[model samples]
Target: MGREFIAYIPGQKDINGQFTKANLGRTLGLLKKLLKGGLYEFGTLTAAYNGWAKGSPEYDQWMAEVAVYPTTAQNVIRDAVVNALTHVKGSNDDPIPLTIVWEGGPEGVTSRYEAAGPSWTVTITGYPPPAKSMLAERRDKKPS
Candidate 1:
């Protein structure tokens, strides 16, 4: 099976207290570009919420599953994914908090990009093995 990751963008509100569509559009556009390489496919966008307590601002957080070809190198995929998500900026050109959970599992590496840092911080776990090409798999399976 191919590898997949979950990308998350925390809901952001503008000065008028409305969820900013521009931010969402910009992020989606970047992701679309990343998919142009033919190695990635973006899943449907899902609405997620946070801070459900009383008087807490509730907004629409967007989550999407990005699937990558199993033959691609892990580091290459990670860099491309992180680069695309981290480039998304708010209306005021501020960094937006974004996250990607590699392999779409609890045990996968969870990389987070916060406004407080200039790079993605892996707060979860270690990296998975580099994917092997179909040809390589077949070659290895051949009688030695």
Candidate 2:
């Protein structure tokens, strides 16, 4: 079975404030590869793009809540997303930072992930539903 989900990419533009079409394309492409590479399954996956024109929303509703499978699938997807986004190059051959925000799951897991040149940060939270579902959120990290 598959699940629906959403993913957000922060700072949609290059350092110069110009739209980075290649960066966006590469990031989404990497995610697609993960989906096709047997990492997990997704239904209702959508990317809320921030266009270069005026009145473009700045980073909040970058994505929406959707579904995802395996419950633990996020960790795998995060690892790949961070790796791929960090490596994405601009027209000037510079690396770009990617901050991905995702929400949705059986228990509603929400995550905000970011990775820059040599550093990365990932935070994921799963909720306990008022009503039980077939899947439970996975929390493997110890409290800091």
Q: What is the C-alpha RMSD of each candidate to the true structure, in Å?
A: 16.4, 15.9
The lDDT, on a scale of 0 to 1, for candidate 1 is 0.34
Q: Per-residue alpha-carbon lDDT of model 1 for 1-144, expressed as tens digits? A: 121111122211211111133454454444454454543332222121122222222221111112332323334434544353445355533323333333433334444545555544443234442223223344456897
TM-score for candidate 1:
0.23
Candidate 2 lDDT over 73-109, as tens digits, reads 5555445444544454455333344433333444433
Superposed Cα deviation of residue 18, candidate 1 (Å) = 33
- In model 1, which runs have C-alpha deviations exceeding 4 angstroms? 1-30, 34-87, 90-106, 122-127, 131-144
Lowest summed lDDT over 10 consecutive residues: which window, candidate 2? 128-137
